[model samples]
Target chain A: DVKVTQSSRYLVKRTGEKVFLECVQDMDHENMFWYRQDPGLGLRLIYFSYDVKMKEKGDIPEGYSVSREKKERFSLILESASTNQTSMYLCASSRGTGASYTFGSGTRLTVV
Target chain B: TQLLEQSPQFLSIQEGENLTVYCNSSSVFSSLQWYRQEPGEGPVLLVTVVTGGEVKKLKRLTFQFGDARKDSSLHITAAQPGDTGLYLCAGDVTGANSKLTFGKGITLSVRP
Candidate 1:
C-alpha cells in the first residue's frame, strides 16, 4: 500500500503568521500536489512539483508557495496566514503523469 | 479553465437504499476519476474511467464514463452506513499535464 503522510493533522495559527504544511510519501512518486478544499468551491490546487527542485503554479497559487528540495518531501508555505486561509489542506502523490494519485490524511488549518 | 460539475450536492437515505451521482463537463476529457472522502481524511480513488462509454465496477459500486468523454456517473447499490462520505469527480484533460479539474463534491449520508 502507498502511504502519504502529512506533518500535522490540525493546526491553529494567528493572522499574519507564517505557516508550513509538510507532506511525505513513501511510494517514491514523481509528482506531488498541494490543494486547499473549501465548501462550495471544491479543491483548488495551490502548487505542484513534478520533480525535485521543479515546481509549477496551479489554479490558485496566490499567497502560497511550495518547496520540493527532495523527492519524498513536499512543503506548502503560507506567506502570511489570514482568517480566510483557514481550510483543509491536502497533499497527493502520483507515480507519474496521467496516473492515479494517493493522498495524505489532510491538515485542517485554522487561522484566527 | 476546465470545470467539472457534480449534481445533487447532498443526499440522505436509509440503509439499503440505492443512489446515483452524476458529473458533467462541457469540455471533453482524457480520463475521469471518482473518489470517496471521509471526514478528516483525504479523497481516495475509488475508480478511474478512461475509455469512452466504459463501465467499471468495484463491489457494489458501478462507474460509467460517457461516450462523449464529457460526463460520468457513479452508482451505489444498497448503500450502508459505512458508505457515508463525500463523493468527488475529477477530470484529466488531454494536454493539461495531467492536472485534474474536480467537482464541488456530493455528501452522502446513509442512516441505519
Candidate 2:
C-alpha cells in the first residue's frame, strides 16, 4: 500500500510564529502538492513540486513557502503564522499527469 | 470562483438506509476522483472515474461521471456505520500534470 506520512497530527502555535510541516511518501511519486482544507472552502492548493528542487505556487501561496530537497519528501513552511493560517494542512503525491494523488493524514494547526 | 459544489453538506441516516452524494461543476474535467475522510485523518481515495458517462462499481458503492465531464454522483446501498465520513470529489481541471481542484466535501453520518 502507498503511504503518505505527515510529521504532526496537531500543532499549537502563537501568532507570528514560524511553523513547519513535513510530509514523506513511500511511493516515489514525481509530483507533490500542499493544500489547506477549511470548512466550506474545500482543499486549496498552496504549492506543488514536480521534481526535487523544483516548485510551483498554487492558487494560495501567500505567507507560505515550500521545500523539496528530496524526491520523496516535501515540506510546507509558514514563515510567520497568523490566526487565519490555522487550518488542516494536507500533503499529497502523484505519479504526474493523469494519475490519482495519494494524501497524508493531514496536520491540524491552531494559531492563537 | 468555486469550481466544484457538493450538495447536502451534511447527511445523517440510519445504518441500513441508502444515500447519494452529488458533485457538480461548471468546468470540464479530465477525470474525477472520490475520497472518504475520517475524523482527524486524511482522505482515502475511494474511486476514480474517467471517460464521460462512465460508471464504476465497488462493492456497495456505485459512481457515475457525467457525459459532459462536469458532474458526478455516488450512490451507496445499505450504508453501514463504518461508512460514516466526509466524502470529497476532486477534479483534474487541466487534464494533465495532476493539478487538482477539490470540492468542499459532504459529511455523512450513518447511525447504527
Candidate 3:
C-alpha cells in the first residue's frame, strides 16, 4: 500500500537541543503538511509545502521550521527544543489542493 | 482562521450500541473530511464530503454534511471495539494556502 512514513515513532530530546523530524511519501503527492496534536489544543498546523522547496507557514508556525528539499521528503525542524514542545507530531501528504490526505504513524516527542 | 468544533470530546459506550459525533463550524467550507485515528497512529481518512447536504456510507459508518457546508456528523451502527478511536473532522478552507482546519476530535471508547 502507498504510505507516508515517519522516521521515528517515539523521540526524546533534551531542552535546547536541535531536533529534526523526517517524513517521506511514496505516493508522489504535491502537498505535505506538519501538524502538532495536543490534548485540548487539537491539531495545529505548523507548516506546509505545496511543491518541492516551497514552504508556507500555517496557523501555528512559531518555534518551528520546515524543509522540503525533495518532492518525496519533508522535514520539520525545531531550532531549540523546549519542554513545552512535547507533543505528538504528525506528517501528512495530499495529491493536491483540498484533497484527502494520507498521514504517517506520527512521532511522539517528549522534551525534557 | 476557520475552526471546526467537535462535540462530546469523550464518549464511552457498550458494544452493539450506536453513537453519533458532531462537528460544527461557523464558517462555510468548500469541503469536509472525517478521520479515525487509533492510539499511536496518525488519523486515517474515512470519508470526504464536498457538496452541501451530502451523505456517504462505508460499512457500518455513515457521514453527513450540513446543508450550508458548515457542519458534519458521523454515525456508527453496531459499535465495536474496533470502532473505538479518536474521530476528527477537518474542513477545507478556500484560499491560496488550500490547507485544512482540523477540530479537537472526539475520543470514543467502546467497551466489549
How many residue pairs collide in each prediction?
0, 0, 0
- Which segments of model 1 are wrong by more than 4 Å? none
Against the true structure, candidate 2 reaches a TM-score of 0.95
Compared with the true structure, what per-residue lDDT tens digits does model 1 show for residues B16-110?
A: 99999999999888999999999889999999999999999999999999999999999999999999999999888778786677898999999
What are the Cα lDDT values of the candidates? 0.93, 0.93, 0.93
Interface RMSD values, listed in order for every candidate: 1.1, 1.3, 0.8
Pairs of residues clashing in candidate 3: none
Q: Native-vs-model 2 lDDT?
A: 0.93
DockQ of each: 0.77, 0.75, 0.84
Per-residue accuracy of model 2 over B2-97 as CA lDDT, tens digit each: 789998899999989999989999998999999999988889999999899999999999999999999999999999999999999999885455
Listed per prediction, chain B TM-scores read 0.96, 0.95, 0.95
lDDT of 2 by residue, A45-83 (tens): 999999999999999999999999999999999999999
Candidates in descending DockQ order = 3, 1, 2
